[model samples]
Target chain A: MAEQPPESARTLIEVVPALGEVAPLRPGDPVRVVIRFPLGHYRVPLYLRGKTGTVERLVTPAIDNEEEGFGRNAGDRRYYYRIVFPMTEIWTDYAGPPHDNLRIEVFETWLESARHA
Target chain B: MHEHGPGESRPHDEITETGPPDYFDVLETALEELLTERNLIRPGEVRHQIDVLDSRTPALGAKVIARAWVDAEFRARLLADGRGTCEELGITFYDDTGLIVLENTATVHNLVVCTLCSCYPRPVLGLPPDWYKQKPYRARAVVEPRALLAEFGTIIPDEVEIRVTDSTSALRFLVLPRRPEGTDDFTEEQLAALVTRDAMIGVVPVTAGKDGSGA
Candidate 1:
């Protein structure tokens, strides 16, 4: 009988970003952000897409996945960047009171300065 | 954007031009593909499971947790091993694996998120809220838990050290939120009335509403 070919094993592969270090953001400056997933990378959030928001404050500095695992030390504390967005801009046709905004803590690397369009 | 490349026109070309779907949509696709390829589950079965899971998230489990929070012995059994104790109340949980129950303390609160994937207590808690699956909430909750709680209308004093637990492993979470004020000697049904889905997730405090008030 002819020899049988070896069977290929099937597995799910998820690509993640390499971590990196970065500077803090100015009040109006955009801080780059990245989404870290145990499974894989993802876009930061739906509400923030194509919308300009302000940086409220900086919490901690930890890792950036782009350059390498910049802040992924097993025991390192992560820095969270707080960003604010007007609710009306996010939820289309929202008929709520004016000036109701949402503040979301996004890590660095998932954001870029929105050049006024 | 007409970003399509030469190979992009091919149905198999998912890497370029074709952008990814929304968060929940992506989850739905992944689950569908997984089941289809494995033949372990069918589309109809998946929908059925989703419906079943959604219907299970009423105040049932929350009521049980509330009762345990008030009763020392029941609470002890709940703390010792939730699986055995849950059986006493006809609420069993084993979404194909063993279960663990963690109570919420005065200073600490627990919220579960399957950062790696959507690992939830489907049998006990049912479908997760839309916000739970968002990347922003999942990523932020672990790093800045208290802030996330505030977004959900929960405000804990600065003195309380809020701990945000990420459920990235096989283990699941059940929050035994602090008993809301003003309802001592409340019946089980009343206590259960106070338990809300948001409370179980630690986003909102368990409030004993009108039903929970001693009549």
Candidate 2:
């Protein structure tokens, strides 16, 4: 039999408290993707670079993809967010209805305030 | 028992020597053997975990969907806490990855894809299909969700907005397909039978026959 999680595991809703240097990005905040070409394994996709999107939700505080990918103990973690962008904004030739959108989970380091962009 | 004499070839030996050894296969074997030799992990435990994974299928997800359809409160629970709610039906999520269920509605359609690596809701939906892990799906699902979905034979209407979610992190997503129109009178088991693996993946919708039989 598969081992059952303890009764305390019933609390499935993850409540990530603000701590450390976590960004103040909240749900519904418009953010622009940072244009960075870091040399190493990274989670941010190439297409999303410099694109603008709204934060959908705060997912969790996770170790940076660089550390996770390279098995290094960089001792750094960032708040991950689910960001939603219009499909039209993502692809220039996107031939879809105007309301179509794409949601991507991204780390805090890849995002910046879109207000000035 | 037939024994291979000197200079004699066996059928199994020929098959083994024909192809180059896969890199991942060699790595996995070496790792497993090393761990077992170091008493870090038992081979039996590894086999048991594999068996657990092998036993999981889309049927388990279908059962959860069926129950959610018949029971309103269960649906609420399922939407609120997908991982915990699945455990109510004896479906355990062994991995720490969290599951979020997205509902398909009249005005909205939901499609899931992993743009990076294949981060799937394997606990509820079993292993992802080959196409789901392919480059075409990972690339196209994000840029042109509607076109990608249409290729899977799911044509969303113009009025309905399609939302494509890229599971890029620890969070995995599953689409809770809208229940078929005529399944109100059907039993949960029959309803479950109508819920195909593709339906849960949001590539298709559930359908029921007029005679109360599932399609």
Candidate 3:
């Protein structure tokens, strides 16, 4: 059989699904939802870390930055997928408008099921 | 080695003799000093690799979004590898960053904000608008995205989930908003018409109203 020529030098790339490969919660499944921010280690937004909420949707699978060689560079390039709690659930006095929500897309590594759960 | 007064006017000649260094002078001096001391982010031939952000072309990511709107496989690739796929569309992200491109599908919505400092992806999406840079928008968007979106005229139904994307890195985001209806076989420019600065930022959906062109 004629050997197929070496693959073209073109770069291989793909968009990560909002959440990459995380098994979705069956409507009633329990999850520790959280907001994720993308930045260098020197600065992580104070409001988001370690806070807990629930996942709203699992849209699709995507590239995992951890496996990608970018390192923090990986973190810098793209964001992880997530949509955590509603506004009321996150804040006690979020009195700006009616039924506001703060859903976010976060990387998988940032999440861990709450011990309380 | 020159200096300028704090709030005093000086002629160009006087200033050149004793004023703050322009970029060229500073670069020359700094490079000489660095070579004399230590070599770092080297200041050699300085082949100015200009990664020109399309200040005139609006947010280039919008075009990618529009393409995803019409092409299913391309959309899948976008969802799979946003930065890589963007490269195919000639949207090369800056080094020291991995990009995440989120789709604003019919069932979902996306919005972006920078709460800490204005860390945006200037490589592909140009600069953030004044509103996006304001402290109010930054602090509040992550706290109350829906309310903020409403202020921008995007009223998401309770049934549909809204996802807020906060770009903390100088890593910018561009929303691939669900394509509007009645645009089958739309030309790239026509499709581009549906891509707006607001849509890319996720402040609002693309529309052909007011400007009668884009969202």
Please report the candidate that would top lDDT against the real structure: 2
Off by over 4 Å in 2: A1-23, A72-76, B1-27
Model 2 TM-score, 2 decimals? 0.84
lDDT of 1 by residue, B1-23 (tens): 12222122424444455676467
- After superposing candidate 3, which stretches have Cα over 4 Å from the reference? A1-43, A54-83, A94-112, B1-38, B44-59, B169-172, B209-215
**Candidate with more favorable, higher TM-score: 1 or 3:** 3
Misplaced by over 4 Å in model 1 are: A1-117, B1-51, B210-215
lDDT string for model 3 (B59-99, tens) is 47767877787788998998777778888987766455556
In model 2, what lDDT does residue A109 have? 81
> Chain A TM-score for each candidate, in the given order?
0.54, 0.77, 0.46
lDDT of 2 by residue, A6-116 (tens): 998765458664453456899989999999998868888898999999998888687787678877645656789899999888888888888999888888888899976
- After best superposition, candidate 2 residue B83: deviation in angstroms? 1.5
Candidate 1: Cα lDDT at B78: 79
Which RMSD values do the candidates have, in order?
17.5, 8.5, 9.8
Worst ten-residue run, lDDT, model 1 chain B? Answer: B1-10
